[model samples]
Target chain A: MNRDGARSSIDVLERYSGETYGRALLGVYLAAPTVWLVSMYAGHAAAGFAAFLVIFAFGLAMDLALRRSSVVLYDERYERISRKASDAVFNVYGGGGFVVFVSLIALEFLGYYEMTPRVETLFLAWSAFVLSWGVCYTAFKSRA
Target chain B: MKNRLPELREREGISQAELAEAVDVTRQTINSIERERYDPSLELAFELATYFDATVEDIFLYEADEDGV
Candidate 1:
């Protein structure tokens, strides 16, 4: 402990603030749409696979950045709090994803929209769902 | 749950950050505890009690229903 009675070293990495994670998530969202569009234009299954790889790389990069920045150490108490916060965000994301997916399928079935069951389209939709969850989680967690 | 973390920290003349460090938590966690936005776990309650040289009951007050139901 220092003069202030605080611990001298942190045992765990700190969680990034909503602002920081939100910005990184935004970058992923933007890049995902562009990749999907390019793949669609190329009209090749290989192009779709490449798009998936690029998006996966972007997600990996964000994870790495978060870990690198959260070098601050914390104890079990802090870890529990962080875990609960993350769990809440993921729960909401899962529910929202399910609802949107069902709604989309229903719209197609009802003839409200023309749906193509193409592999590329499926990949694009999945990517969009993931990015949207990131955006929502960040926005919700960042609220004052 | 209501706690005396803020009052106790003030009496000790330590910042929330300092208290958090002493308790091995983030400053935000301390702030939330003080504000009653979150409750500490049993292990954490004991840690805080040990740090403040007080019993857990002294720092955290629990009240049952007035009717004792």
Candidate 2:
């Protein structure tokens, strides 16, 4: 390809990759909540498991697509900016989530709110996993 | 930190997109830099200076404190 053609292609790739990543991120949030709601209303363990499988498969596919696209599109500057943005977002999410979780626990202990041990454990595990994923992903992407 | 990015880019006959492409950043980042809403990292500043064939000091102007510290 000519110089201009290559440059344009790179631009297109960057845009496509960014959009795909954004959509995938949004999909995780939407799909998970929708599945949870569906499972809650359906009141069936099988239904919940099925929904979990579907969401997991979708997430895996998106992860693969993002990996492929990012490999082609990311440069040093892009990586640096992405790292900084990701870190900032992760810090806010982690810190805010921790405060909220502690407050909820305190309320539960004080009898102002009620939460089962199982539910509390699930919430903590899921949130910790997400926070760890964000941190790890940023570190991986920022690495040379 | 205030910068003369827009002026320099205009003088060089390049759009924000073009400058962003040359500097390996998003156009939004370039726009933010031009608007003085975002400050570039030292490495990015050096990259911009190198691309414009000028020193970083020539491109970015840092204002002194009112107390003159």
Candidate 3:
């Protein structure tokens, strides 16, 4: 038995996991739109802006619904599930950014692409790298 | 990883908030450990064990089966 045995009678409070989940919602919102915009303006206007907006709105609603309550931890397993999902996104985004950056550099060297003043590609690549590593530690390291 | 933090904490009759203050962590962090949702760094684990006047093994247990890795 441990000291907390006395307080054991106190029911565990379930805080909503969606507060963190809200971030994922925000990530998808940002990522999808940005990608769509890049593709459209870069040369795919066939992808209607209205269509992306509708899909983004639906995701926003889903995110809100998921984050409505704070009981993210129904049990240890639920925490694990959320952690894994979050980590997966972070890792993918991070690794993908690096690959894209290197490819972009190669393209530029070959005169296959031109640099745009409005888009600091290197900075975005760096941001994604740092963010992904941070999420990796926060999410996976917790399980350690 | 598994821990007996809640059990040790209860023996002192201190709330998670109080334990967190003593150990310099957030209450949520303490709760996360108690619920086995998160594992503290070795330094933090040692701090908790020391604060509780117990060995690390006395406070936290390692279960290979549950290893997230």
Cα lDDT tens digits, model 1, B1-69, are 788988999999999877876776667678888888878889889999999999999999887779985
What are the runs in model 1 whose C-alpha is more than 4 Å off? Answer: A1-81, A106-114, A118-144, B64-69
Evaluate model 1: give its TM-score.
0.48
Once fitted onto the true fold, the runs of candidate 2 whose alpha carbons sit more than 4 angstroms away are A1-115, A119-144, B64-69
lDDT of 3 by residue, A41-138 (tens): 77875674765777688777655544333333123334555779977986687667668777877888999986675446665767867786788779
lDDT of 2: 0.75
lDDT string, candidate 3, B1-69, tens digits:
688888888889999867876776556678878888788878888888899999999988876665664
For model 3, the stretches where C-alpha displacement exceeds 4 angstroms are A1-94, A102-144, B65-69
Models ranked on lDDT: 2, 1, 3
Q: Candidate 1: deviation at residue A103, Å?
A: 3.6
DockQ sort, best first: 2, 1, 3
Q: What is the DockQ for all candidates, taken in turn?
A: 0.19, 0.31, 0.05
Model 2: lDDT of residue A92 = 79
Candidate 2 clashes between residue pairs 3 or more apart in a chain or in different chains = none
lDDT of 1 by residue, A4-80 (tens): 33222222223444334545666776777677777777886577667867886877776565444533234455578
